[model samples]
Target: MAIWYTADTHFGHENIIPFSGRPFRSASHMDSALIENMWKVVKPEDTLWIVGDFAFGPAAKDMNWLEMIFGQLPGAEKHLVVGNHDGELSQLLPWDSVSQLTEVEDNGKCNVLCHYPMITWSGARKGALQIFGHVHNNWFGSRNAVNAGVDVWDYMPVTLADIERRARKLPINKHWTDVEQRTAAE
Candidate 1:
């Protein structure tokens, strides 16, 4: 089974269409497109890593949308790193695991996974990669960090290898492990 990563889906958030300039005709269209496009890649045995912002709008109303969307996804297993939009109700959703942050490995490279980006992560100094979703495609906070949100990746989950290749092309200076401490000293 393969593994994939994605975030900032905002499934039922109608405002996202205009705000993000997505071409969907409506929230329903956007949600349907996302689900259909994702199934083209993901399968029943694949592991899907959703970084954050899976849904939005009223708590009770959105809950129903969340249930339907999650249940329809083809992935056999799913992991969630809660985003800003996720609430206490998120705990009620069915997923293999949920957390604010976690670590995952692809081949020989280790990656720090989170809903938001960070300047330095657990193994930043040693070349561990950072995979995040909150910034959408608007920003790439650090060199070693790659934004895995759908807005940046054609609205489908991407593989770890895809992230690693993109991360490798970022400016070398942006990945400096000491940037945080150096900024604080300044």
Candidate 2:
């Protein structure tokens, strides 16, 4: 099965938060749109790596909602790399949750998975690449990193090409510009 990665779904984030400008008139509408888009690209045998922010609140309150939406997606299995936004996922959801940064060694290359970006100097010691989410933008260093954020569109899953282009440019000295943050929020 092919493995796909994505992050920052923000399912219940309907109204635009002050920090993130995601807009939705209602929670149900946002959830429906997100689910519909996710299923369009995902196949029954495909595996999805949801990096983080699976749900908005307490597990009990959000479990039913998440189950309903996730159940409709066509995927053989789903792996989660927990993010700051996800709360009590193990207690709320049946799926396994990983608390630490995950690493994969493939074809003489190493892949590191985490919710946050590492310091610029950290990339110098890496192997193949490091893929993560959380910063939205303003990634550091030139080792290899990907942003699986909400801005990624449906049907078009994040591709290796996209990741490569962004990853090649690293050691960003400045913080994520306000414009970039606004774009992500939108």
The numbered model that scores best in TM-score is 1
Which candidate tops lDDT? 1
Candidate 2, 38-143: lDDT as tens digits: 6777788877767777666433256676777567655787767888877764325655445547764434555676777654323333434666777643333343
Candidate 1 residue-wise lDDT, 135-183, digit = tens: 7768754568888998988898999888877877777554464564445
The true-structure Cα RMSD of candidate 2 reads 8.5
Off by over 4 Å in 1: 59-62, 173-177, 180-186
Q: What is the C-alpha lDDT of each candidate?
A: 0.82, 0.58
How well does candidate 1 match the true structure in TM-score terms? Answer: 0.89
Model 1 alpha-carbon miss at residue 119, Å: 0.5
* Candidate 2, position 61, lDDT: 58
Model 2 regions lying over 4 Å from their true place: 15-18, 58-60, 90-92, 105-108, 120-127, 137-143, 152-156, 169-186
Task: Report the error of model 2 at residue 88, Å.
Answer: 1.2
